[model samples]
Target: MNRRRTPRSASAEELLSTLQHLTARARQEVGLHQARVELAQALQGKMLPAALPSFPGIRTAARYAPARDGLDIGGDWYDAFLLPDGALGLAIGDVQGHDVEAAAFMGQIRIAMRAVASTAADPGEVMARTNDLILSMDSSLFATSSFFRLDPATRELAGARAGHVAGVWATADGRSGITSDAGGLPLGIETGQRYPVTRRTLDVDGVFVLLTDGVIEGPSLSIGDGLEEVRRLVSAHTGATAEELADRVLRAAVLTGHEDDAAVLVLCHEVTPRDHG
Candidate 1:
């Protein structure tokens, strides 16, 4: 006897229903992912400085690179503005963490630091006050920052660092490095701790490069190596405009797998004098 024909494994209707369910799930997942990506993009755009301030006799350029694999924004930031007294304020800071919380904290710290600098004129005292403010908040939050007051007339830079990467001064002749003072811990570490200031009289036609750790502590490169790279790049591009040189250094850092948030600020003393009519 002919064996009963095996029932069809699945009716066309049943197969179609299963496929529809799977497609719906996939679409929902895709929609969620897209929303996340859009949100991240918006956040990243917001985190960066919308417009850098313009100062007389100063051409400032900044670049920020977020981690290649993660969110596009982090705690790295830069600020440059002319003080009321005609002195220029140059600053770079990194909040202790990443994301929205860190960005908010960075904004607050940067604002407070600038306010103090504008009024105090002493980099050390500004940093000290900033540290005190940070300490007053939750101890868990902290930041690493470097602030500099530039006097175009005097060609002097009064600087203070709070656990930030050191500032490098490179001249057409040679390269010199400046480090933060000892016992100057990162902000929010302790109240009443003093962050010492360092003063340097930059040579005319010299270039000062300040950057966040994202440029130095990159993968496949040590801090020293990264710094050396910066020195070399700056030296090679001595003839390049300050903005162009800044762009080159930032590009080099990004190429070298500096996946964290990165920022760079450069100050170059123009060799030519402006005609004051």
Candidate 2:
């Protein structure tokens, strides 16, 4: 005797209903993920200082460019804070990696460096202390940083570098120069090694530009080419504000295919005489 076969179970209406439910769930999940990513980006934006402090007879502008990977929150950072004696503390640094971990490490080093710089008049001593602290904390972590103290009154800037790139100084007469030191190893490398500090006299209305290697180490261009590009862009926009010049440089870098994370801080000394009238 042949057994009667049972009819297949799922109905057209049932299949349609199931597909609709799955489609709705997928749309909901996509929306949630989008919101999460947007929130993360907002948080990263907040990590940077809301506004750079204003100083007497000085103008400052800065720009931070996240990488195209959307995880652009890297170890690169710039900070301007007040010292106890009213001298402004200016610094730019880049940790070895480029992720959330690097950003967190940058925050820690930034705070410690600020503290050391506030009390120590010598840029070398401040960097040495910061280096020692970073070294003593961990054996595997490393970073490169440059610390600078700008005296608006004297138009002088004293700075120390720990394997970071030398900043460029754009003179009022359209000449560009680099502030290069003998250079010391990056932080967390060798303890007790002294980093030398260099001093430069900035001209009135001159601009100093500090940047991370990300701005120079692109896949298409060599470091020298990047520097030349930066010089060209800055020289063309001599009348632009420090912030505007920084923005132009970074935009040009991206247009030229500098794919890594980028950061720039510019300080311009404006000639504003006291009101003796």
RMSD to true structure for each model, in Å: 4.1, 4.2
TM-score of 1: 0.83
Least accurate stretch of 10 residues (summed lDDT) in model 2?
268-277
> How much is 34 displaced in model 1, in angstroms?
5.1
Report the alpha-carbon TM-score of model 2 versus the true structure.
Answer: 0.84
Candidate 2 stretches greater than 4 Å from native: 1-36, 273-277
> Residue 18 deviation, candidate 2, in Å?
9.1
Which lDDT tens digits does candidate 2 get at residues 199-240? 877655667788887887677787777777777777667677
Error of 1 at 132 (Å): 0.6
Backbone clashes in model 2, listed as residue pairs = none
Least accurate 10 contiguous residues by lDDT in model 1:
174-183
- Relative to the true structure, how large is the alpha-carbon lDDT of every model? 0.75, 0.77
Clashes of 1: 0
Model 1 spans > 4 angstroms off: 1-41, 44-48, 53-57, 173-183, 274-277
| Top candidate, metric lDDT | 2
Model 2: how far residue 102 lies from native, Å? 1.1
User: Model 2: how far is 159 from its true place, Å?
Assistant: 0.6
